[model samples]
Target chain A: MSGDTRHGVGVSPGTAVGPVVQVAPPVRPPDDEPAPADAEAATAQIQAALATVAGDLDAQAAANAHAAPILKATAMIARDKGLAKAAAKHVGAGLGPAHAIEAAVAEYAAQFEALGGYFAERVTDLKDVGDRAIAEVLGVPAPGVPSLSGPSVVVAHDLAPAQTAALDRAHVVAIVTEAGGRTSHTAILAAQMGIPAVVQLHGATSLEPGTTVAVDGEAGEVTLDPDMALLEAQRERRERRAAALAGVSGPGATRDGHAVALLANIGGVDDAVAAGAQDVEGVGLFRTEFLYLSATALPSVEEQADVYRKVLEPFGSRRVVVRTLDAGADKPLAFANLGEEENPALGRRGLRLCQAKPELIDSQLAALALAARDTGADVRVMAPMVATAEEAAWFASRVAAAGLPKSGVMIEVPAAALRSRHVLAEVDFGSLGTNDLAQYTMAADRMEGELSDLLDPWQPAVLDVVAAACAGGSETGRPVGVCGESAGDPFLALVLAGLGVSSLSMAPKKVAAVRFALSLHSLEECRALADTARAARSAADAREAVRAAASPELTAVL
Target chain B: MPQRTVTIASSVGLHARPAALFVEAAQGTGLDVEIGRAGEEAVDATSILGVMALGAKHGEEVILTADGDGADAALESLVALLSRDLDAEEG
Candidate 1:
């Protein structure tokens, strides 16, 4: 049993070997507790507990700058004078510190819960403070993730988003959860943070808190008390991967010199700055919705331009494709909240929402134009979810009228892909949003996990729609690109290039891998792979066919 | 005691980051600061819960009252803070 290995789904790609540290679940106060003989002393004791909890939270917030806002907010709940006064009064009435704190928090929690919306979420914060105070008073280890002093593998029954957010990421070498899947918050965040993660490892939390565990995220294997040789081998493999990726850089091209402009997908000014530093060709998908999504009012053209300038300024002369504010029923922009809808997925969204509020679209266009001119960057604005040629033309003219350099339409809808020539004629470029194209083609909700199978980008139908969109671009001599999750997948990136996509944009972290994938084979080989994938009967079959035909090196990394 | 009235400039009103910042600033002053909606009962400006419970929205006028030697200075600072878009700076 020296080589005992437990298998699970590797949600993130990497390997880590460290001691396990189980995050203790929130402790509950005993329902019944005898009152202290001295009422004043009991009240003082609870007050000290509250202060200690508050101090701990304040220290934690100070330690991690990113968690300061949330942690400081929770610390306020703990140090709340009103909460303390009520709890002390309860203690004066002969209730125990734990019970008093719980009751006091509950009183505030009810008020917050009644307020609804964003306020309603604060009840959890209040409860967390209550839990900490209760744990401190009872002399128990604090609930939630315990602070780590060394590199560790965090073992949890299931990480709540709050706990996941609060974890001291520097100390966490790997994350193992007994529950959650690839799409779980833990997995998604782990991937984004570049952490090695394994999910659904049934008994991960049962491991002794300080025992060593070797986690292989790529292989989805957890080895308990792994030997030195195994750890060294894993380290060597990681180094090799790093070396391979380091070998490929600059503008992406195949061995046969078929140039594919590999660009980064950026969400905000921060993302734009970070991605701009990476080895990508340029910014292919500068998502502008994030700026609008976080605002309560429609930002003025100047305010919007300031944000756009922040994003475009970093890229300089590099091409930056910005998607205009694309919010609607589901996303619900605060300035233009359309309210509850029967079918938000099929309802007014993206460009459709822009039509309902031309002022919003016009303001955004003016801002983009101003930002483009200010930075001297090549900015091509795009419209999302454009279904018809008229909508595409409407968006292109608006973009031109605002003095933006170029216009493009996201080919996300099936209608746009099928009648691509008409849509392509109205726009300067076509960017296939494969994720949504798959969702629309299969009539699957992009968000609903149950419909995830139908939304798989590897499905032949999805590829066919993408091919149609690409063909439209080729016919019109307009450049076509992919700015979807599919573009990030290196093997799929090849298929896209084969289908005539001139560029690919994805999360900045994925650039190195996709670049490496492109460097392996010629454009003709990519076309053959795409042909093989399209001829498959199913998504699984398509993936397998591509894998079978792919170079061994591609299969190894993918 | 000194008091100043100011309109909330934060688009999200006097809650979230704005409320937190206001409470933090009030606590920093070490003076008894009370804030209330026009003609309403004042709550402790240092208490996040009390401040949040006010449910003040954007463009709503609120009165700030402070006691102690620096009371006038504190009220003026708070009023100035409330007049500007505090949330906008954070974003």
Candidate 2:
């Protein structure tokens, strides 16, 4: 086992020891294999491999329907005409059947990435097809472990898109990818799946498969061949966590019975529909940019409307708060192009772009209104990066004109939060985007991992912004909510409620834990807890205060 | 071919609700009709999905196209239908 050192990506979380179970990489030709006597035989092999990949994707999708819609869509592309036919053309070009398949698939995948948006989504599908075809030609199981049958720390050098998607999230305790970034899709998905994953671990592929390992997600560490005692301790911790998180439901309220709406922040209409199907109260932040993210130009008013309708239809009478496009130079669009700047986040983005391009804002507003009218849902629209009351008022007026009932502004800028009263006065509600708020308040770059300490939501400066925003919300009589990562945290949720936030929005999976935490304390207790946290000197001290003040059960879960 | 002018009633017109309505109307006519901004070239109108995909906005002007028996009548009726508010127009 030690000699093999099979390398691939470590996806998911947890550590277990088991036998080697390599999900071999897709079939490919031997370096010295002679030309086949019959082209027909090679063609047949390629076709069979493609069909097999398609079948695997379907099976995986059916098994994990709740995972991500992109999985199913990628499956569709694997069997698409553009891809299948493109591979056949390579055969005509006289490349080996396996080489033909790999070359053609790569071309499309590159094209999709270049195209971005919906097309860029196809990159994973193309990679899947390529891997499978090459594996079939080479006579090996596709790369990565096919199934983690026992508790073991799986090792991998690099992970492909499908390999990452096909991860058995339940069995895998933690993931250590040799080559990947924290912002890579694998990392994002792992975080969303509640699995501790550490990427960019050098020599991950050098570890023997089935070796006992320990992973610390918060620390981004993977310890290979851990002692038996450590494994037992980790397992005990996990089981305790499960018990603590059990029975979380209904609205997230504090011990004193102060009610704070618990909602899910979703990216697309599909996500809205799926999460809405769950027990979530309503959609907290419906990222409206998805409707236009993949488009060559700004989505037409009608295009935006159709999506809004689909998104709102799921929530019905439930409130669906739509956030207008948050794109900027960092997330540039071909149609709504903004030139590069020294700092994309601080540069023209969010509400600033909407100001420069009222037509884009108008189009989004019109669609949202149409969806509201069609679905009869309580729809609300909000603008991102509103630093001034003027921007908020400008956005609100447009939303009202578009025929939507309510409009609000996201207080991501400290200036906006400090003057939140005035900004909220112009809008119907306020939602604090804590991630951006923290970044801006502390003068920290979000992308800079080294500033992770400053970026902590518990940072005094970040909390100060939240407190100011909440106070502003109260002054204006407009309800406020936290829709950033901090809201997903149970202890923080209580503090936010104490700060006068009316709602807490987070990933759907986190709602239960937060709700459970809130139920353990009263509104007054939560207020006291918030004060204790605020009085602390640093983020660490503040975090400790929150933990100490929280109920034993909540503290244990943390 | 027949032509008519209509404001995209749905605030974000032609792309969302207006587009859906236009697609439905073009489908009903059984005429090879096209729709587009007032002065721009029109796309195939019969395909509801395609028409909606165009993303026309509220209060925007769109030209309609069709040919053959009752083509003129179909274009006129469809254009008139498109001019109205879609939510009220829908059954």
Off by over 4 Å in 2: A1-172, A177-187, A198-207, A214-240, B1-91
User: Which of the numbered candidates is closest to the native, going by highest lDDT?
Assistant: 1
TM-score of each: 0.84, 0.64
lDDT of 1 by residue, A202-301 (tens): 7887888898999988667899989889988888878877888898889999879999999988888898889888787788888888778756678899
Q: Which candidate leads in TM-score?
A: 1
List, residue by residue over A1-558, the lDDT tens digit for candidate 2. Answer: 122222232323333334333334444556665555576776677777777766776776677655435455445445544455666777766667777787777775665555444344545555766776677667776655565555544445545555766677666655566665433455556656666666667766656666556675543555555566766766787777677667666666776678899898999866887789877789888887666765555767787788778878888788888899898877776578766678898889998998898888888787777778878999888999999998888988898788778899998999999998899999999999998898899898866654656777888778878999989888879999989878876778888888888998877877777888888888888888889888889987997788777888765544
DockQ of each: 0.58, 0.05
What DockQ results for candidate 2? Answer: 0.05
Error of 2 at A91 (Å): 23
Say which candidate scores most in DockQ. 1
Residue B1 lDDT (model 2): 49
TM-scores of chain A across candidates? 0.84, 0.72
lDDT for A410 in candidate 2 is: 91
Off by over 4 Å in 1: A23-52, A83-145, A156-164, A341-347, A435-456, A459-461, A471-477, A534-541, B1-4, B9-12, B25-33, B39-42, B65-77, B80-91
